[model samples]
Target: MIPIGMIDALPFGNSRRVRNANKFTELKASIAIRGVIQSVLLRPAADRFEIIAGYGRWLACLELGLTEIPALIKPLSDEEALEHQMEENLNREDLNIIDECKAVQQLSAFYNGDRQAIADRLAWTMKKVNERIEILKCCDEVLEAVTNGTITVGHAMILAPFSTKLQQGTLSKILTEKWTVSYLRERASKGQQNLALAKFDTAACNTCPHNSAAQSGLFGLEDQKAACSQPNCFKEKTASWLEIRKAELTEQYGTVLLIQQIDESDRNTVDSLVVGEEQFSVGCQACEKRVVLIDDRLGRALGSTYENQCIDNLCFSKCVSALTSPTPIIENEELLVAALENELGNTTPTISTETAPLKAKKAKTEVSCVVPKKVIETNKAMLRQTSVDLLMPQECFQLAMTYAALKRLTSNYKSINKELSNPNRFEDTFKAALRLNVSDLKAEIQNITLHLASIESDQTINITNMMIDNITFAADAKAVAVAKWIPTKEILSEYTIGSLSALCIKAGVDKAMDSKKEGGFSTASSAGKGKFVDAILAAEFDWSGFAPDEYIALIK
Candidate 1:
């Protein structure tokens, strides 16, 4: 026990307070009631003692106007004192991950980059130590985002697996748009963590911290653990794994097989070597899943469902044979689902009171590794036996595209189309256009748990022609076009308000909120318009076309 006056802070003191410094009011109250619970470490200075730790206690004593505080006198060098201060603060205070990371790094450097020494001194597990240091390895954008309040440690950890450019863009969208952590998490994990669900890699997914399974405690909440939190990284890894497998298979088979971006388009789609190799045409079974095609949104994405693919059982059996187990590097969705159910395990999340059931449960079927191809096949066969008009997801997706395409091609629109301006009219017209009487589209979607996956570049060009040949539109196609366009205003109001605000900021627009009342982006907002400004700009999702005035008119 000693008087507080006996121990001097430092010759320069630590400015008494730093920015974002934690308040000591609670500590002050505690000491005022119970006195100092632990003694601050002190070392002999020139005339008095210097505090090596317990700055909070020193502050508390000062706040309580106490003449003395408990002190443990020790002998330490300046560097040793700093180390003690850092370690003590880290263990005591719930420091942010970035600060904790920096402190860990300083300790490592102070000990000549000795991992074991740092771990031993800090009394931390090597795993924990290594993980903390890993945070410091993130790109500057991610680190800065963490340092500021832009992102949580969990977000940074997930982003650590992606490209630097992607991290920068994702962080920008997150911060500028004020997205919820849940939304960011869901968006980040949108696809099968970049590995197609059809060819999901269970073993890699199970062990990766980027996998929600490996990140159980990362978010400090059970439900908050997102699945495949780094889709970009997952996609890259899956692609590399596929390439390595392809090479090995090529070496074994003594010829080339499936090539081109994962969507199987003709850009690099047709192999000259395969021209003479018609006898060895292995399969285009997973062709759509294995190629990348450019989208109308000017982005590279996967292809769509292939129904004209008329193979049914024959193709299915062939796929099974080619993808049988113990075969060198062949992955299929059902097998991945089997691994998920048996190996990693899938627990349906308990519904949370905080989140809306619509949003929370929208993802229920999505995160599951269960493959629906067999189930859908069974449904199709049953439907074929009954009436074939019961529309499945594949059928519905094609219908939606055909409707959009037909509308685009249709020219004549005048007063008769005015009645179709209502948003509900589009839904009705879309169903009417589908021409399915017995099937309820919404129910079918829910039952099948269908995602369109991708629009497939070929569909965009040929859908109108295909639809014209098969079914006829009820009203003037222009009215249907107007109906499809009607939903545009609803999407603009509901989804794109924040997105527009974000785009405006990226375009260097001034005070985006000034136009928020009407939910419109003004030309005066910035000089950057029409042109995509950011590397990963999302103008399509944000609602482009129709200037501020014209768009407001349309909405009205």
Candidate 2:
């Protein structure tokens, strides 16, 4: 037995936060009448003992003016004592959900954010631990509702992801209108912002009440774990940032193309801008169709400016289609001026009579296609605010695939397929898109642009192939050297046996083929060139390492 004064009570224990006043009162009465029926568990703490369990029994004995009480005293580490307290509290039937969550939170903090340790010590599932920790993000008022039995733990979980103001507002509706858990969930889903795709800087979001990370006090969220509670603020910031970026680029270059979101049905808009694979050139930056595809979602998510690619799919086909047979295909005023300035150092070159007809033809084409400024501004405004609703489940799946493909095409980042497949990733990817309103069962998709040149060209397979080619055949000589461009039977069919043999020799495959049989090259040659071609194709070697000679160019 230990003296009652030697034992210290928990500062925030179940006994202090009464869930059932009558039950606690009866316990105290029972203790007074029958003495302490159960011994309280305690841990030695220097000069005194700390209650590890049975807080109510200890409190009742202390109130009854008992000088000594039965106790099982043991020496335990801080972590062990916390585990004991949480285990005892969690098993109680009358423990308030709020207090239960707080106990779990304290245990979590005691282990320094090692949730698995808490789970293991308490023999709780990781999912249960995670849910309890998430509930701890709920504001004091929302938690109070859970304690008061006005809302369930499920309602608090849904409300935990939103701001305190939003939580309070939604709580009033839930109380006045008697909303179900599913309805509250639906409302919360509509207002979330996926921080992964945000265009603007999010350093301030760390402390903002509207961010889930701030609400939970979580830091360094690299994935879609963090979300914005205020969708309107996120939308306005993205829109404003994109506009400012566009303006800055426009000032640097005469005209810059902006690529945002476009509907899959309106494929012609991006199709008109990007027609073919236009090679990059120093003078191409001066062209009106130079693209600046703004992928605010990925740019902000990955913390990379390279996510905003400068697509150089110049309007090559568009320009060629505008020219007549008499006009030289290379007769663009910008190109001509650029070339003259490069060769003659600021000398203004006069237009020869021979070029007059070409200039006149170009002028006619420009005048014929002139759109009014008001019409252009209206179109721009409409494009800026575009939203798409994907109704079918198949459509949603297809969009997810497209999003994965875009990530591959536009950046060096890889392995996003599994990430996008997760349900939470899918929700944030679709729900928090710019101008996208995913309400209830419906999803509004936006913020996708395939081409910066023309909205009509987004659906063009040619542009997609061009992008693939551009990455596959990179600008760096070393990258092209190691590119995995192995020749298939179809590609080999284009090359003659002589060319194939030459490439095989360069790759050291000929030596292996010749050594396989006596007089192998002679025998294969005598049988016909097909034998040699077969030998080259069947050779077990790294074909990607081989590059054909310049003399064996494709028969274009």
- Model 1 TM-score, 2 decimals: 0.30
Per residue, candidate 2 scores C-alpha lDDT tens digits across 1-556 of 9998898864333322445778878998998889887788998877998898888888778778889889998787654665677777788887776666666655543443457877897788999878877776566788888888998889998876455566788888889999999998777667777786676898888778777765453475444467887866886787688777755543333233222221111112222233221222211222223323333332333222221122211233344355433244445676666556657865654554345433433233321111222323332232222211112233443454455334333322223233333323322333222122223113211222332133221222432222222221213423343343455665554433333443455567757767886666555534544555676677666666554433111101
How large is the C-alpha RMSD of every model relative to the true structure?
A: 31.5, 33.6
Which residue runs does candidate 1 get wrong by more than 4 Å?
1-6, 10-23, 63-65, 138-150, 161-168, 176-556
Model 1: how far residue 554 lies from native, Å: 86
Candidate 2 stretches greater than 4 Å from native: 10-19, 45-48, 192-556
Q: What is the C-alpha lDDT of each candidate?
A: 0.44, 0.52
Query: Which model scores highest in TM-score?
Result: 2
Local accuracy of candidate 1 as per-residue lDDT tens digits, 283-392: 23112212222111101222221221211222233333433321333144444444445445455433332352221111111110111232223322322322222223
Cα misplacement distance, residue 320 of candidate 1 (Å):
73
